[model samples]
Target: MAYTLGIDIGTYETKGILVDHAGAVVAQAARGHQMLVPRPGWAEHRPEEDWWGDFVFVCQTLLRESGVDPRAIKAVGCSAIGPCMLPVDVMGAPLMNGVLYGVDGRAEAEVRDLTDRIGEDVLIARCGNALTSQSVGPKILWLKRQRPELYAQTAHVLTSTSFLVQRLTGEVVIDHYTAANFAPLYDVQTQGWVDDLAEDILPLERLPRLMWSNEIAGEITGRAAAATGLAPGTPVTAGTIDAAAEALSVGVDRPGDMMMMYGSTIFIILRAAERVADRRIWYAPWLFEGEHGSMAGLATSGTLTRWFRDQLARDLDPAEAFRQLATEAAASPPGANGLLLLPYFSGERTPLHDVHAKGAFFGLNLTQTRGDMYRALIEGIAYGTRHVMETFADLGQRPARLRAVGGGTNNRLWLQATSDITGIDQEVCDKTTGASYGDAFLAALAIGAVRRADIAAWNPAAETVAATPDPVYEKGYALFRRLYQQTRDIAVELP
Candidate 1:
């Protein structure tokens, strides 16, 4: 009765699953945590408490609940929100809270500085990405300039998954898919750490060893075994980011097979036939050796809904609030009765990459209700997603099939609105367990229990969200595009 253990630390929750050799989920466990926002445009997580602690709890819970022998668990796979910026000492102890991905805009100044210093063309040619808040290189520079004392004491700069992998196996390694986001620090052509560019920001030695996602990083140490209640010497794979694992979970492996992840933010990954170098979107090496990956993300998606639920629907019970909002939103008509929203609460990513962008509700009137506002908010995010998809189309990289995953996929309004706005059908798998399930499959791959092509058989797509074209959405999407351009100057001036 051999099995694999998979765990993923997401923005607001950590989930773990145990799967038998046949890909049947034996048991699952999850833990919720808070995303600390110290100030505007900054997001951080206490790695020790939120990441490692959750890993330990989930592992022990899964083993206890399933009553599966710890020795039966073969390989372990992990994924997390990334490419986060976390400075750790030589012992891999956290020196500071982990800075989140594109949503954290503290590196705005550093992004501009590096783009000017390194030349956008050179960066794009070498790393296949431009300097933006999402680029970990800029975040590293921001740390050096803003916290020189801490930077001086730093021994390693680790992302969330790398941190967990090291904790599990005492090996500091990162996957190529995740490392590609470390723009200006990672060389796409060379597929390795760029010493010449990274040395200027931080020593190259501080970077983790690079490997493909399926490769075994190291065996779990005795110390980790004791903490996790798993047997010592269990193999752990070089895992990837949550979105990549989520994509894999839904069998997004072939060229033009895309996965749209509706989580804290909306993340899109498309399997490309070849490496793409574009300023509007990022492309990188895929999980396996030969394939290529193209990606884009919105800064805020699910988070906007959370904010509304907390602030506007505070009187309602937390559990009931979302349902109430959804009920009202579903009842509202397509255009939300002339209300429009820009879901730039955490600024914009992907095509715009505008850190100064601000969220707004346009056409709000006395007639508008909470349900109307909520529908408009979801519709705005859908429009933003369509903007990214159009960029892919411009590059001749439109997705042939779209797989939907993550917590937001469970929201009918959001998913249907996205379909309507983008005019692309979305396929949904029977198991929307998200990234942890993908991690389990990756673990199975590392142990030779599953083939690269076995994912479809393991988790087949069973449903689809077909595009429902609406005249209102057609006109609103056009207005959505114009609103951003007309309001850009004003958004930049916001204090």
Candidate 2:
């Protein structure tokens, strides 16, 4: 039977799946990795260890556990956290740790400089994005200025998935969806790389060859085969960012369908009927040709929960901490007994685009229990999500259908709170394997084994988190917004 292999490199873990032609998962494997924060406002990952290493381990594990012949895997697809900036040498070796996505704010100065030099209106018109923490061009400029030696030695700049695909096929390439994140470096109108906007970022030659997400980039080389336990010459498609793949996995194909990914961050992607030229949200060419996508995300979500567990819930076992916390949180009422939180531990992304934003637990009282605090934390994230959705609404691009995916969906409190605050029903798919499952489906599409519409059949929605409005949430959300605004000056001034 024909099969496909899908693997995704996430912020905290790497997951892989083996799937048969009928969309049933034959086997699955995963490996965990860390998102290194060497310094404040910076995030990095060791490409060799965290990315390729986890990939190799997961792929081999899937093959061994499934006992499926490597040759039976007809095609391969990959997705990863992005758009990361990893400059590699001519031999395709990383010059330094990969700079992570918008969560890493090391290039704030560069972002400002570029925006001031080239007007935001021009940037929005040409690049379809504003120079925020998410833009790769500023990060690249930061590298050129801060680390000239490495920049001098750099051959090509690649994102996480580009690095992975290159390691597999020996063909350096990137997908249009991921490439769009390289604002000022990529022109949306032409759908190609351009060095004309702030030419000092890098020569256009240093960028990868762009392809659509489902296009076959190249075949696996013998060297890659040896490392991955796959047959030599196996076709691999040009993969995309993890969130995009996750969106596709849940049947988010048509315009107005949004995927609310509750992973390391709460990433939201809405397929748009046409290009959305708004700085408040991101715009990129969709996986398929002639389609458009708009995106928004919080700086922290699941990561914040992990931090709370690690710091406050130290008595609980690591494995059971989240579950225990969820139980405790559920006991608290809708308003979290008058507690509010700002989930800006890593700064804010989208809408606000404020890198200096601070996380806080406002209105804390001695009477409030740990459960109340936990509930407030989850509610804060929900409020942030509602803020994003409202922005889309103001732009006349609100989602008609919202599908929730990723690990956070397992947290009933978090899921219900998001719906309660946002007042949007969230459809949960049967398979929450997320990007890896989406990768498998995309692999099938690349090989003509499946069509885009087949995703609904592969992973049908099993349930919906219905919205239940409460007056408490209405007051809390208002306070949530006001707390951020009133404290913004003090927050940014702090060291």
Candidate 3:
């Protein structure tokens, strides 16, 4: 009657699950949080409020609602939307709000400074990534150069999951997957920190110890036990970046398996044998050993849909609004009747590393309705995926198949559009996201309840929907490919 818990903190919400050896989410809970936007192109989250507070709720709620024995919980694994930079004091108190993932663009200047200081080739060769807002190093440089007082007082810099682990186990350590984004700061080739990358960056002592994501870092302390309502000594592993963990949750265990997560920001991760270093695509070691992967990113996927809903659907409930939009969008023919959109509302990433890239609509005839615009947005995101998918293929790293997960797949029409545009057969995982399932699965593996040697024995949720591309989509996707360059001029013309 033992159990495991997988808790995940996302950009806008937190979700957790309590499950036994068989992988059924016996009890689940979630809490929503507001993303703070103080200025244009900046996103922040109160680490105490959004990151750990929601976790407190999920932990307590799942424990109570499941009626599971607190002591019987073999382990707790956590995952978070990350590469978040929040410098903390010695007591694990946040010095300021966390830089909210890649969505926040406050560190553009720092990015340039890093690329100039370290040079792109050294960064790419060493950390397997180049400077983008996604890198933790630039954020650190921002704090150091901009807010010297905070940087000087800073006791440690941590990502989201490691922050939680510090609060839980009274330990400060980051996983390699999360630390990989600390490019130019972490010497991945040497498997250690590179203290000499930048003279103006945060002090080297601030970085946390790095470990593989699955290695048990420490046991939850008594203080964390009281807050989370769990046995104090329960083992907690060094978790991973939310996307990598989500990739794991969707059965991207072995090499060549790809997980395309359709969530707030669409993330594509594919496993490979050796590091296929590409500046266009991020490369990182997978959670467990003998696995490495490359990542493709889209800044706004579900964010675009959410934006449309907030601005256009003031009269509709969330469910009804998405349902109506999906229905109408589905009714529109492929390519939304010759419409194309570049979904770079927050700026494009992956395949094109432009931070100033803007978004626009092409072939938007006056005859097109709001519904057509909505479907055009959907198609734009699908085209974005195809752009990166083609890059992977060009590198001879194309995945054999794709497993789709997260909230975007909840809308069958969106998933269908994505599958059609990419021409990849999509398998929709049941409603589970992030590292939660992978947390449970990893816990299962740890205790020998489920053997990792045979993945078939560790079954994930049954596929609820399957999408296959139609041949008619071929010419449409080909046309969609040209829209990025064709519309780039129009997008910049707006402002």
Assess each prediction's global lDDT (C-alpha) against the native: 0.93, 0.95, 0.81
lDDT of 1 by residue, 1-495 (tens): 999999999999999999987889999999999889999899999999999999999999999999999999999999999989999998899999999999999999888888888899999999989988788999999999999989998999999999999999999999999999999889999998986765679888999999999999999999999998999999999999999999999999999899999998999999999988889998789998878999999999988899999899988999888888999999999999999999999889999999999999999889889999999999999999999999999999989999999989879989999999999999999899989999999999998999989988889988999998999999999999999999999999996
lDDT, candidate 2, 144-163, per-residue tens? 99999999999999999999
Candidate 3 per-residue lDDT, tens place, 267-320, comes to 999988788887889887777655678998888898888889999877888858
Candidate 3 TM-score versus the reference: 0.94
> Given candidate 2, what's the lDDT at residue 103?
97
User: Best candidate, TM-score-wise?
Assistant: 2
> What TM-score quantifies how close candidate 2 is to the native fold?
0.99
Name the 10 consecutive residues with the lowest summed lDDT in model 2. Answer: 192-201
Give candidate 2 regions above 4 Å deviation: none
Quick one: best lDDT, which candidate?
Answer: 2
lDDT of 3 at 8: 84
Tell me the deviation in Å of residue 131 in model 2: 0.6
